[model samples]
Target: MKQVLISLLLIIALHTTAQQKTENVIVITLDGFRWQEVFGGADSILINHDKFTEDKKGLQEKFWAATTDERRKKLLPFFWNTIAQQGQLYGNRWHNNFVNNANPYWFSYPGYNEIFTGIPDTAVNSNDKRWNKNENVLEFINKQKGFENKVVAFTSWDVFPWILHEERSKVYVNSAFERIGFQSPTFNLLNEMQMTAPRFLGDGVRPDLLTFYIAKEYLKTYKPRVLYIGFDETDDFAHGGKYDMYLHSAYMVDQLIADLWGWLQIDPHYKNKTTILITTDHGRGDAKKEQWTSHGAKIPDAGQIWMAVMGPDTEAKGELKTKGQLYQKQIASTIASFLGFTFKSAKTVAEPVSDMLSK
Candidate 1:
């Protein structure tokens, strides 16, 4: 009887260890994707009239398919239909509400710092500030047992190495400036992309396409447990006041996101055990008729942001109709919970929002 009891305990311990080993999490950020775009289309949330065209009825025939949904379906069919249908998204309608200016600056670096560090800063005034990211959630997880070697970050933004403090040998971050392994074909393709895509005004512009390419390469080579891919094309296009470019970039991001999700399904290492979280660092300025070329200032709705999570652990909250606000800080805790990690930070973890967790 004693031997049997000991055998049962050993089996339970081994199973728990295996469960922990198999689970993985991926977080992807669209630099300037408004919550409006995530829930609906680009028609209604145009901060700039220049960006808002009447659906280009003619282009609908040439560019889009028969219906608006079908047209968008072609560009980012996974985000609009597949993930939303299978997962949960927030901040479009009244149901899933989120705060504007979650970070004081309402801009990229500050917002991203907040999202990864799980805290808000009231003093950050510009993107120019040299980012000093300390104790990012991923960094914390990397220090723990079993997660030390299974983490990575890829970003179109050149500054992400600073934002996440990836310069530390402990973190594996491959950004615009990092050298991908030269031997791999993926690395070769990425190098070609960087050469073709010029740096805009020395600020460093990484199109979503390049970001996706790097992520795909990383996944193929090293299947890290926690992966972050930051896409900056939408923000770049928005800053340029190129509304068409902005929308086109948004569509492109959607398509890539879909592809990554699908790839996970076919890959033996990731199938059935992985989770994905998609969100934006922040939103665009809420100018109904402005030139569609600004953020960081206090526009009426510019501060708002949105997020979506789809995984085996996520509960299916279909088409939320009520209004509720989620803060960027909650992301750290939510992600920790999803991976079966006991969140120890009282400062970071609140009761996991019921809308996000599996029922």
Candidate 2:
């Protein structure tokens, strides 16, 4: 009887500890990044396109290389060096691993909707700046115990405020040119810096670097249980036919991710318990120079995208050079799983990736 009692007590104690573990989750969107450059490398053909680049020789010397792996490493060294080795990456279509948006509309609104709501709604066929009717995963998480008022979003595009349905969701969305308010000296400095920087498209989009700094300060200060940051320069640069700027933005975003992960490891609230899920709202065309800057229903495979997961509870599988496919709707469930929750998909179209979580 004594031995049996001891075993029961041990089991209960372990279960309680597991229940008490605090897991922080951060979701980042690269905004219309392509898997071609993510997995394969910089496109040699596109580098010399007169329409896309002004200094082909200079760009080539910096990002071009004899091999795909070599080029990718130079472009995104932190990702290839640290995240790839320690985390899991998917959507390398060349290896038959596919991840695509589920929404029929292969654009920002629908793709982001599918990602956050866990289902593709044909009703969201346009990128109109209207409040989203669908409920998002962040809102759902906020309703959960201990997560109320602890969910926040920082996005470079003003459209995100509508996508998140901030008015209805009450998720504390500080997006685009909207200030996040003063939390620290660093955040205040960024606020002042924003005043001096030139506004993009009349503040519909802010600089990606500014967004990163604001979100970073928010994470360090408030320690929100769930955070989402959307960086949009890649998409903007691509549309403007500035390939060099696009490439540089991609590299900068990687470093931002590295910095955030490093901070999480140092912060007591996030150390050893933070999980990051990085992905894009859409994928741009890359079949030709023209297609490289385009993503829409007409663009082939524009809905296809990629994702990376890193945390204490994730497998160290690195780049998934194998046969598999994931839909954007599955991301919400994946995020929930990272925090030890079993969330039923809002649309119930798919489940979380079984391999993404730790055993």
Candidate 3:
């Protein structure tokens, strides 16, 4: 009897410790941001663009009057003023930065796969394959004894189902051109909207607004500990060279982030414990001319990306000028560290960017 009683007490203590150390971490991927956007501020690109002509002069005026740091703060105001002010921003400088790739092709799928798995898989070349059977670090963590119900992912791209290996139902994901499963009424509505969403006027790309909405709704209803929201509109618009549309899409995403963060703050359970980790899979070119917006295999700048983090264990009003560079894989390791979870991927990068963590 005494042995059983001791075992129960130990189990209770372990459970309590796990509950206290756990945190809700949400990752938002901003598909194609130029490093210049964070480091350079608005320059000649704003002036020549017809759509931004009105705001161009004002932006220039503020940029010139402010210090370089201040200008950066202005362009990504929310990040510099709020998120960066509270957490850490990476990849804007030449300091101790280190870089690596999980795949030879530093494009979307490879980058994302590296991020979720902790290392790049050389064998995986394209996202052409319809399904991913490989286990992800997120999935591994979710299967652990204490974290069984905590991991979830929502992405705008149809490939995520395969990318994260959710096609087999191991992970929860809503992707693919065709709707595959059914859930609640709210999800049904979301499915209907996605299915019926009008394709872009000229090209046939499907609008991803529905995915964002579904992710938001899922967050509100499920309150999962880990959430991944991937937005592709900016990447699509950038590729189309629709400057106005690209900027608008980015702004809209910004608003959504503000809303998401606001909701977290107001929620009784997550208000004090949630962290928002935002980054991009890749970046676009430096050109802001006729070919201003686009990124891919041909563009060297496309491979570069940055990250911004905010929330619990993140510093308040802090900026990190790290000399050490990190690749996409570090993101997963950092998140696991924040959540007090053990990541099981053999390739998972264990080094957490310390500057971002709360002091």
lDDT of 1 at 152: 84
State the lDDT of candidate 2 residue by residue for 204-253, as single tens digits: 88999999988888877788999999999999998888888888899899
Q: Assess each prediction's global lDDT (C-alpha) against the native.
A: 0.70, 0.85, 0.67
The C-alpha stretches of model 1 lying farther than 4 A from their native spots are 1-22, 44-75, 94-96, 99-101, 129-133, 200-203, 343-351
Model 2 ranges off by over 4 Å: 1-22, 200-202, 287-289
Ranking by TM-score: 2, 1, 3
TM-score of each: 0.83, 0.92, 0.80
The digit string of per-residue lDDT tens for model 1 on 1-359 reads 99999999999977755545328889998887776556545443342243444445533443344454654455466776887688777776445555443666778887887777667766545566365534677877787788887888888888877778776526777776455764677688778767767666344656667768887877878788889898888887778766566677787787788888889999988997888888887777654547346667665456788787888766677445567667776776667766666554424433444467654
TM-score of 1: 0.83
Best by TM-score: 2
In model 3, the worst 10-residue window by lDDT is 199-208
> Candidate 2: worst 10 consecutive residues by lDDT?
13-22
